[model samples]
Every structure is written in C-alpha cells, then in structure tokens.
Target: MNGRSFSSSVRVGNWNEDVSLDEDLLKDFLEKREKGELLVQRSSNLNKNVLQKAELSISKDGFLHFGEMVMLLNPENSEQSLSNPSPVYGNYTLSVNPDESAIHVKSHLTAPCGVSASSNVKPCGRNAFIITSVDGSEPGEPLCYGQNFALRTTEEFMGHLYLTSDRKSFLKSSKKSHLQEVSLTDQDSFETCWQVVYMDPQLRLEHEGLPIPANTKVLIIHSKTNQCLAVLRKYILWTLFGKECEITAHTYLNGHRVEENENHWIIVTGNPSDDINTMFDRPKPLSEDINGS
Candidate 1:
C-alpha cells in the first residue's frame, strides 16, 4: 500500500470480477514471513535502541571505566593444556545467570571455561559483565581502587542480574561454611555491593585515586560481609553449557592478615586503548580496614 503498484488482476468470487492487487508486494510479504524476517527486523531495531542507551566507552588513561563490558579472569588458571586436557586447564571467567537454566528460571553465578571441553574452543563470552558504580557515578568515570561497584549481567532479557552473596550460606557448618555462595539476584541490596582492592601491596599505599588499569589483577571484596570474591578451585560443576568453576565469597586469611592470591581476579575488556601491562604495579588500600569494617 505504501509504495507498491497495484496493477495485477485476480479473480474474485464467481461474479467474473477482477480485483486489483500488488503481486510484488504480496510476494515480498510472503517471503519475509516465511523467513521470519519481520520478527527479526523488529528485534534488531529494539536491540539497536538498547545498545545506544547502554553505549560503553573506555578512558584515555587505559583504565576500567564504569558501564564498560568486561570479563573477570583468573590468570593463575587461564591456560589450557591440550596434551593433558585437565579440568583446571582453561581460563575461567565470571558469569551471571547463564542460559543453561530451564525456561523462566535463573541460574546461579559461575566462572565458565569454554576451553575445558576442548582445547580448540575459545573461552566463553557468556561471562561478560558490566561494572556499575553503586554511588551513582557517571558512566564515563574511571573505576578506581577501593570504590564500591555492582557487577551486573549484560543480558538484556535477564533484566538486572547482580552478583550477590547469600547471607545464609555463611551459617552452614559443612566444608563450605567459610565460603559464602555467590549467585545472581534482581534486588540491588547490600549483598550486591562489592569493593575493588589493589592486589599489589605497593599500590595499596601509593595509588589512591588512580583508575584501575584493564587486564590487571585485583580483589573484589563484598562490602556487607567483608569477604573476598573467589572462584573455588576444587569445586568444578557441570552445567547445561559445560563444566563451570564455582564462585564464592570467602576471606582467605593467614592468621589475621588477608591472603590476596586466593581471591585475585583480572579485569579483561575489549577496549583497545587499555594498557595490557602493569596490573600489579600499583595498589590502594580500602577506605576502611577490611577487618575493622
């Protein structure tokens, strides 16, 4: 009706009447409907609007910025050995509410290593995350050490899936008693708040206001419980997608001091301007003492 030429004639009823129709338009509509292009086109348009609203950017200083898509990696176990084919070989990345669950159900948070299945497979991108400021900072603001932020899932359909630690998990008397179970929740409660800590002891004192560099190792400490977010190395579990590493909120302690290595994680992003090196070059202490807080 909009632009088609209605010159085609079609038989109508038994009155020998001729009806004018746009054959080309009718054919095009039928083809598009058969191929499901109409639904796809509408979905694509909606995604475009969502992407524009959630436009992410990087900082010139090569630091992790708020609202940027990132993958949390543990370098200690990132590599996969094809010859050995160990369950612990592949790189593990944090993921929230993976699509492995039943319809209308949300899965728990996990660190999936796609390469675990085969050495040829690349690390899974379902682990993508977005670091958003809990203090309502602008998206352009650089994420700094000791700043509180919320890790949110990037899936649009999942709505607001935030990384959260279950308080009830702390009461368990089993082997996992010290480890708080981490999961995805729609609520933005205190359990969703996490603070970034410098992994390097030197940086803890020297770099207070500097933005955390991308691909650098850092500690994510839960604000409410003062526990560090960690991937349970021994707790590999199977999911609908593949084998995934279990995540927890546990404070690794050597006597009264914090054990940094057990909870270390690297922030990986696709921002080309990021500095790939200098992850442990500097550090900053949390605004308040972790134990005292």
Candidate 2:
C-alpha cells in the first residue's frame, strides 16, 4: 500500500519542537484516552510542544484535503487515551474525492489495528501534510487482499484484483471449512467495483455439497495457508443452479488495523495457515495516536 504523506512533525499548538513519545503508547493514547500516566503525560507535553510550526493549509472553500494533517489541541479524554499521559499521536486527513467519497482517514494506522477511539470534532486543528510510503517492491506475494491490491489492476475505486481470477477454485478439494472463496472475474474483464464470493457455512467433507452463504458475513480467507483473510465489504444474495446462496467479499487490510471490529465491512489479507490477523468483529475506528483522525 502507499504510505500517506502526513508523517512530518507538526505543532500541536505553540510548541517549538516535536517531542518523542512511544509509538505504541501514542497508539494506545489514540486507542484509549487517559488523563494521567507519566508516559501519557510526557506524550501530551510533547504534543503541546508542536502547534502550527508551519502555516496550516486550507482550501479555497475552506474544506480540508487528504494530505492535510490535524493537531490535537485538547484531545478528548477517552478510556483509550486517558490511560496514559503520552502526547496524543492520532491524526487524520479530511479528504474528498469528487468521484469516490468524502473520507477522513490516514486510511489506517501502521499496525493491523490497535483499538477503537473517538475525538472531539472541534478540539482538533490543522497541522501538517500526509507522508507517502516508499514506492518499490512488495513484501509478500501479490493477491487480491491488502491495500496494494496484492495482484490486481484497478487501483482506486475499481478493485479488479479481487475478482479477476479465471480459475473458480484456488484451494484443494481435500480441505473443507465454514467458508471459502472462488474467482469470478477475469483480469481483462471490466466490470463494476463490487465483488461476489460464494460460500457455505457448513460445508460437507470432500468438497461435496458445500453450501456457501449468499448474504452471510464471511472473512475472505486465504487458500494455500487458510490464514485469516480480509473481511468482505458489500454483500448480496443470489441463486445458483436453482439453489439459494450468498456472495460476499471485501477490501482486505494491508496488515494493519486500529483494532478488530465486528461487522466492520472490512477484509484482511494474510496467510490463514500462519499467524496474521484476528477473526471478524464489530467495525471499530482505528487507534488515534500518531494522527488523530
């Protein structure tokens, strides 16, 4: 995935320099707010030190863009952040794509997920720009999961990677599980953005009479490894060969989430065989440490 450009040190208010705080602690501050904690206090002190070092950017109509960063003036004291005294690190870029949607995101934090967090809308102020991730080779094999599209074409709204697989079955018949995925589109076929994956909750052994759900919520589990996969976003129900079924899929995470959430319409991509991500949970906002969103 692309690293955002909102990484530069920005003033929280009137501070002259950027104070160092724990990445994890800062993440927790965003995750759970705490009023007092030596570490949390130090973090707050540091944030207090960074306030508009450079002129804040604003749009002509007075709307914030994606690259623009916000400083936490008086970050709300939530169970997530108040647990510690470290400076608040959560930040977000208020951006709107004319064709897409108006989203306030750093996308997500550096980790798979930390915890659910909330911030006062007015207490936050503009600060810096979004820092972009390095453009180069990827870490693991490309797939339809992760922010990078693992191995698909349509980058932005058109996530063709997840659907563009000619083969219907990537996994072996010997294996059986509560859910499964099969490719339904081709790399060249230009279809709508939404995807469809057929699955059955209780599949019979030997791949016989496997019944995947048509509108059921399922994690887009990987094939070879069977590790926890991304959560399917859009869901719909349809018929197959005179039988009822469910189709689902989602934009997988790039191995990072604030914290796990249920029914959070998000998919995670990683090896199911190995250690990667947690199962599905209620959709919760990511940690608010580094960039308070």
**In order, what is each prediction's RMSD in angstroms?**
12.3, 23.1
Off by over 4 Å in 2: 1-56, 61-67, 70-116, 123-293
lDDT of 1 by residue, 79-149 (tens): 33444354465446665324332222222233321111111121233455688888989987888887888
Residue 78, model 2: Cα distance from true site in angstroms? 22
- Model 1 clash pairs? 203-282, 203-283, 203-284, 204-283, 204-284
Query: In model 2, how large is the Cα lDDT of residue 105?
Result: 19
Report, for every candidate in turn, its global Cα lDDT versus the true structure: 0.58, 0.25
For model 2, residues 1-293, the per-residue Cα lDDT tens digits are: 45433333655442332234435557767655453434545444433322213222222322212232221111222443566555343321111111111111112111111111122122121122221112233332111212111222122222222222111245521012223332322232322122212222243233322322211233333333333322221122221111112222222233453212211222211112223221111233567334563
What candidate 1 gets wrong by more than 4 Å, as runs, is 1-59, 77-87, 97-101, 104-125, 169-178, 254-260, 271-293
The backbone clash count of each candidate, in order, is 5, 87
Provide TM-scores for the models: 0.60, 0.18
